[model samples]
Target: MSSAPVVVVATFTAKPESVDTVRDACKTAIEAVHQEPGCDLYALHEADGTFVFVEQWADQDALKVHGTAPAVGALFGAIGDHLAAPPDIKFLQRVVAGDPAKGQLRA
Candidate 1:
């Protein structure tokens, strides 16, 4: 797998009646996120009843900027009232893929 300084994987379960609303709410922010300087990937997927977002950033600073972006706030405001529960989010590091394990980081 390729390397990224920051990778985010998030999951959100929309209250059955709120899926469309959630998806629509995320459009603006996702569009703007794709235009950000260090955003290598910002893809959303739907499976079962959950929405998932996978993101890659050039570095930590870039990720931090995304946290404060205007579109981000707008997105939350639009969807905040409809989420089934709070979004499940995490920052990850790729350590293994397929059949191999890569070297570990010491820091």
Candidate 2:
């Protein structure tokens, strides 16, 4: 099987009173994406009202599909009114597969 090619790390700070709503929306998005064909992992974490989304996809194409999915679109739309600032997103290429100390780097 091919390894996941793209990993996305996203950070969002929710408005104090809207934290629960934001988290619920993010959770729904994660659940939706996790059911898609090329999604490897979809996780959401929260700390002090800040939500972090981490996802692993088969490739760029899969990531693109996730980005355009209705659930994701709706989540983004809903979060806009509850976010402290725009979400921060970063894409990474996996260089290691197992233990950090033992895994080989891609380059």
Candidate 3:
């Protein structure tokens, strides 16, 4: 497994009637995820009915552990029914481009 730091982008679309419930559940999950080891970032963004999460982990091992974290289970249990479908999660590798200070997710 790769030991490099990783970034994750996860998107969840909430059913029209369940936006608030999804948002609240995600908020609670973010709080708990922030406390996880190797979690450099775990932020939530909402627009229309879509919720986006931008997260950074120290390494692949940490990301793997986070997949089964209790916070993740609780989040799924709380908002599974409210979601339009399964969350879309993508793991990304950053490529250097513009300014080093602003081009990537930094701690």
Candidate 4:
């Protein structure tokens, strides 16, 4: 089996009044994560006050660096009061790629 770091996906629902604030905070966090040495991808998406974070790292160490970054800390500090609930985070390993119409296996 090929060895690769797992992907992290997170979804956050923000209070209506705090949507913009959350989006800004997430953007800052993404930027910080993107600059990390082993970060593959760090992106944030928003829709109707819902925010999603999609991150890919080279390994656990890289993810740890992101978790402790000052920008992430700042974002957490700023958005804590604005969230309706804690963010939902998921870790996944790719099982398929290429085309959705055709099944593929990871190995």
User: How many collisions per candidate?
Assistant: 0, 0, 0, 0
By lDDT, the best candidate is: 3
Q: What stretches of model 3 exceed 4 Å from their correct place?
A: none
Estimate the lDDT of model 1.
0.80
Q: Which candidate, 1 or 3, has the higher lDDT?
A: 3
lDDT of the structure predicted as candidate 2: 0.82
Candidate with better TM-score, 2 vs 3: 3
- Residue by residue across 1-107, what tens digits does model 2's lDDT show? 43546778999999999999998888878777778777877788899999987777877778888888888888999899999998999987656477876762221
Model 2 — TM-score against the truth?
0.83
Error of 3 at 77 (Å): 1.3
Ranking by lDDT: 3, 2, 1, 4
What Cα-based lDDT does every candidate model obtain?
0.80, 0.82, 0.94, 0.79
Better of 1 and 2 by lDDT: 2
Query: Distance (Å) between predicted and true CA of 89, model 1?
Result: 0.7
Residue-wise C-alpha lDDT for candidate 4, range 40-79, written one tens digit per residue: 8777888889998877877787777778888878988989
Task: Give per-residue CA lDDT, model 3, range 1-107, as digits (tens).
Answer: 78789999999999999999999999999888999999999999999999999999999999999999999999999999999989999999899999999998887
